[model samples]
Target: MKVFTALEAKNRFGKVIDAAQREPVTVTRQGRPSVVIVSAEEYERRQSRAWRNLLAVMEQTGRYAAEQGLTEEALDQLLADES
Candidate 1:
C-alpha cells in the first residue's frame, strides 16, 4: 500500500488512480488514516468473495438446523416470537 496525504492525493489525483490500479492506496488526513482506494476489479473480486462466504455460512447454518431437527415452520415461529 502506498500512503498519500490528502493534499498530495488531491494534487496528484491521476497518479493516485494509477497507483491504486496496481494495489490499494491509503490516503491520510492530518497524519491519520482516512480512506483506501482499490481498483474496481479488486473491489468487485472482494465483493464476490464476500457474497460467496455469506452463502457458505448460510448453507452451513441450514445444515446445522436440519441436523438439529429444525423445520421451516419452527424457525418462522421463533423469528416471529422475537417481534
Candidate 2:
C-alpha cells in the first residue's frame, strides 16, 4: 500500500491513480488516514465477498433466533428495554 497526504494526492493525482491501479493507496488528511483508493477490480471483488459474508451472517442469525424461539415481539421488547 502507498500512503499520500491530501495535498500530495491532489497535486500528483496521476501518480495516485497509477499507484492505486497497482495496489491500494491510503490518502490522509490532517495527518490522519481518511480514505483508500483501490483498483475497480479489487473494489468489486471485496464488495462481492462482503455481500456474501453479510448474507451468511444474516442467515445464521435468523437460524439461531428461531432455535432460541425468539419472536419479533420479543426482539422489539428487548430493543425497547435498551433505550
Give the candidate number with the greatest TM-score.
1
lDDT of each: 0.99, 0.98
* Candidate 2, 3-72: lDDT as tens digits: 9999999999999999999999999999999999999999999999999999999999999998999999
Q: Which ranges in model 1 have alpha carbons more than 4 Å from their true place?
A: none
Residues 14-62, candidate 1: write the lDDT tens digits: 9999999999999999999999999999999999999999999999999
Candidate 2 lDDT score relative to the true structure? 0.98
Write down the TM-score of every candidate.
0.95, 0.73
TM-score of 1: 0.95
- Candidate 1, overall lDDT? 0.99
